[model samples]
Structures are given as C-alpha cells and as structure tokens.
Target: MTEPKTRRTRNGARLPADQTTPRYLGENIEKDLREVSERTGGGTMQSRILVAAIALFAERGYENLNMRTLAGWVGLKAPTLYNYYASKEQLLVEAIELGMTDFFSYILDGIEDVPREDRLFEIVRRHAGYKMRHRLIARANDRLIDPQFARMFLPEDTARHFSGRMADYRHTVEELVRDYVADDALVSPKVATIALLSQCDRMAYWYDPGGSMTPEQALEQVTILIRRMLGIAA
Candidate 1:
C-alpha cells in the first residue's frame, strides 16, 4: 500500500494523516468563529488565531509550518500567539479535542431515539457517514493520531480531559455492545465489538462512491451484518 501522505494539524502541528487524532474540527470551528466574527463585527483573538491556523496547517503540512508563520497569519507576533497557546502542540491538542467531540456527537445524534435493534446500525452508519462527509479530516486524524503519535503528546503536553476523551468515548461504544448481552442477544459481545469496529474502520481505506455500493446500501448491508453477528432473528 502507498504510504499515507503528510498533513498538518489545524494548529499547524506536523503529523501523519493516516491516524486518529482530532484536529481538523478546528477548521469547522474556525470557519464558524470567522462567520461569527464577521457577523457580530468582532471575534476573540484566540478564535481568529485558530481559524488562521486551520487554514495554514491544512494547506501546508506541519513540517512546513511554524509558530512564526502561523502567528503572521493571525497578524500576531510569535510571542503574542504564545499568550493563547503554550506551544503549537497545545493548539493542535485543542483542535483534536474539537474534532473528536464533533465526531462522537454526531454518532450520539444518529443513535438517539433509534430503536434498540437499530441502534448499532445507526451508530455505524452515522460514523461512516460522518467520516465520509469529512474524509480529509478523518484521514488526517487517522494518520496522525494513531497510538504512537498520541503518546508523544500526552500528559505533559495536553490537558488531561482532552487527551483522555477518545479513550472514554471508545469505552462508551464497548458499553453499548455489552447492552446486546444484557438483552440476551445471542452474539458474543467481544466478537460484535471487534467486528463492528473493524467493519467501520475499513471504510477509511475503501470508501468509493461509484463502486457498485452506495453509502446507503453499504450502511444497510453493514447493519444486517451486525444483526446477524448479534444472532438477532433475521
């Protein structure tokens, strides 16, 4: 397989784009911040900085970016930028936090009030849909935030809450799987969880619009796969 291309974090931190670290949501956040800034005729300095950083980082991978360049984008001196972010790394962390929160929030929205039997289907469909909708950001997160890269920035480098949120949300999914057992569904909880994640993860590598399966169809098929995995009566 070809190696994943390099991508920049919203904070302009250089990392691989083939992993899972949340940062691109800052792009959306930045856009919203800019819109509010324009409409209200004012925006927080920090918000402008994030918006600029999102653009700069996305255009130029982190390796080609630096605090000075990022500061210049926001019309700030490099030192002034530090007033908002201790380091570019911290800023990247903030971006990642934004991205992850949005990611899971959509999943929660998808599953909300969904019939219990359809909950898993909705979760996977929404997840795949969200990722497809924001494929670039998703790819960047996947490439950049995999286990090793994340370890490089934990504890001392980021807020405890932001750093741990991904793990916490992931455990939440596991809890949802356990619910299947509680309902006396005939699935092995372990297999169901693993299968679900694996199936979803494959979307990142193989989502093609014109390749026989529409996203709607793909989701329906996966939903049925999960139902079968759970041994729910077909």
Candidate 2:
C-alpha cells in the first residue's frame, strides 16, 4: 500500500474523502454529540431519569415528587440531575409531555382510518388495555389533567403546555364521536360520547392489572355496553 489519496481544505488540511476521518475531527464530532445529548437529555442516564420521574409523578403526584426521590430512582445523586434537567418543574413538563404524546399517539394511531363503526370497539379496548398496562401513565395523566390540579399549581408555561395537550386530546375524541354520529352509528353524539369516554377513562381509577378481570374481559364488557347504548351492531 503506497498511500491513500486525500483532499485538501482551504487551510491545506487533508481529508481522505469517503475513506478515513481525521482523529481530531472525529473527537470533535463525538464531543458535539455528547454536548447535544446533555443539553437535550437524550443520553442513557438522562432518559432514565425522565422515565423515573414520570413513574414517580404518576405514582405519587406532583406535590409528592421531589428531586431526591427522582434521583434515587435514577440511581444518581440529587445534585447530578441538574446536569440534565434544570429543575423539578422542567422534569415534570418533559415527562408529562412525553406521556401525553405516548398516550395520544397510541390511541389515535390505533383508531386512524378505522371506520367509526369499528372504532367503538377499538377505543374501548385501547383505553382499558392502556390504563391497565401503563398504570403509571394512567395515574400521571389523570392527575395532571384534573381541572384544578397541575394547571393551578405548576408554572404558567409548563401548565399551558399541558393544557394544549389536554385540549388536543379532547378535540380528537370529539371528532371521532362526531364522525360516529354523522355515520348514524351513534345517537346523542356529544352526550353519548362524553358519557362513554368518561366510563372508559375512569377505569384507570380502579383498574387492577392483578385483578380477576383481565383488561380484555373488562374492555369486552364496556364495548358491549357502549354498543348497546349507541345502537351499534356488535
């Protein structure tokens, strides 16, 4: 092997195009990636802290959630979390936003392009199963969304961000109900939809994954009830 070719930059530094990267440049890229990850909290330990924070917030609610508890869950010193999130409120905002994103994404993704007639069953099933399976998300979402809860206590910007997510969730569900009524699958569109959603959403309040009734069984009963109430077939 004589010598690999190289291209020179304006400063006369050589780069082996598509062949090899300079050691200094490689180090710089790695450094930048780490910096960005730190700022964005996408690093492994940082994300773990967020996960723990969400779980704690869900299990204990905001007032009970503290930096020490969050740090304990992430297996880090309390002061170490500052390296990722600026404060507990910032952590709460990020975790709730992520949780809402997951909740809506899972529900909407399941119902999209699905006919209103079929959507009834899917919604009930998804709602029950999600609440049962993702208890932390269920608890956290419920607490954050209580009309007088987070909105009244959290920072204005953080609270407003959560309010937007809550609004979008309501709108999407409303649209689904409207579609159902337009298709003649449901009567008393708004009233019936609200009633039915309240029924499904409240399951999280009492849902026990370890209980005798599995999520599927509970969903089946709720679906049957809603179908009967709406005059939907099966």
Candidate 3:
C-alpha cells in the first residue's frame, strides 16, 4: 500500500496525512501565552485571568494545572486568585461557559438576516474564522467533550448545562442541513451535520495563523470544501 502523504504548516508543524482524522493538539506554551496576553490586553484583570486559565488548561491539561501556576501566569498570588475564582474547577467551568458564549454569539450574530439558502455557509465560515482567531479558547472548548474530563472533573450541574448547550448547537446544524438538503433524497441531515462540523472543528488542531493561508483565505477555502461536500452548487 502507498503511504499517505502529510503536509507541514509554515511553522513546520506536521499535520495528519488524512484530513478527515482530527490532529492531536500540540503547541508552544510560551508563544501561546504571549499571544493570549496580547489578545487580552486592556481587558479587565478578571478577564485576563480567565483567558490565561483557558490557555493554560488547554495546553497543559486541567489535571496538570494548579492554582499557583495559573495565578503566576496572571500575576496574582494564590489567595488573591481565589478571590476571583474560588477554585480551579470554578475557573474551568467559567472559562468553558465564557468561550461557548462568545462562540455562539459570534457565529449566530446576524445569521437570521442571512438568506436561508446561505445560512449554513455563513455559520461554517464564522466557525472556521473563530477557530483560527481564538486558537487557545477553541482548544479549551474541545476539552468540554472529553469523556474523561466530563466524567471526572466537571460538576454535575455544570456538565449537564454544557452538554445541553452542545446538543442545542448540534441540533441547530442538523436543522440547517435538513433545510439545505431538503430536495436531495440521499443526504442524511444528521450524518451530514456531523461531517460538516467535524471538518471545520478539526482545523483548530492543525491551523497556523502564520501559515500560507490568511484567515480570510482559509475560511473561504473551508466553506468551499464544505459546500462541495454538501453538493451545493456555486
């Protein structure tokens, strides 16, 4: 059998040979922290801490992060950090909620005004754009679906709320797929919805802002691929 071909980003990070497979998360912590700091500049101190916490949790794993380390990243003493977030778990929950809130708001904003036929494409475009622009929070959002993390780390109410929000998002996509493919007998909305989201979401693992494609170009290319996948005519 011929070996599958892999490609490297401009930064020389190798991606999976098969585009359908999600790539493993790997990033330079120092670089990510610097970017996070720059992005959160002028935000409230609490907001800065939350952003730092998300970046740290995403890159270092929730179990691997501690209050002291998180505080140090945000220039706070451990006890002072507790004034903002009672515990690391609280911080995690808040971070997840904040990230999801921003994601949903960004993607859904003005979607209602879009022509019905173009709504799915708009959503996909926004999703791809957000993933590229907010790499750290996107990675942190990915952790919400990890079986181990949900089962072991999340509080019951928080887990239930997150799961419900995710399900609602999936259902929204499925509805869009159903409407988009209403005339096609062969496409299953449920399956197509999963495929479409999987394609866009996986970009978080391999996309590099410094890569050959600018964010605008990348979003266009991704929406084009998704349109082709869904058999939408240009």
Q: Every model's Cα RMSD, please?
A: 8.1, 17.6, 9.8
lDDT of 3 at 87: 77
The regions of model 2 sitting more than 4 angstroms off are: 1-43, 58-64, 179-187
Best by lDDT: 3
> lDDT of each structure?
0.60, 0.62, 0.72
Model 1, position 88: C-alpha lDDT score = 71
- Candidate 1 lDDT over 19-95, as tens digits, reads 22123423333434355234322476765665445444554544455677677556678888888899776677665
The prediction achieving the highest TM-score against the true structure is 3
Per-residue lDDT for 1-234 in model 3, tens only? 665686554567554342212122444444444444454443567766776677667655676665776776667778999898877888888877766776788788788999988888889988877777767567776876565788788888888888899889999888888876664558677888889998888778678888898888878788888888887865
Worst 10 residues of 2 by lDDT: 19-28
TM-score of each predicted structure versus truth:
0.61, 0.69, 0.78
Q: Find the 10 residues in a row with the least total lDDT in model 3.
A: 15-24
Q: What TM-score quantifies how close candidate 3 is to the native fold?
A: 0.78
Give one digit per residue, the lDDT tens place, for model 2 in 1-234: 555465554567544332122112122123322332343355667655655566555545566555765675456777888988997777877766666665676677857688876675676677766675655446656766566777656777777777887767666666666755664543567677777777778777676657898777877777787777766677
What is the C-alpha RMSD, rounded to one decimal, of candidate 1? 8.1
Q: Of the pair 1 and 3, which is ahead by TM-score?
A: 3
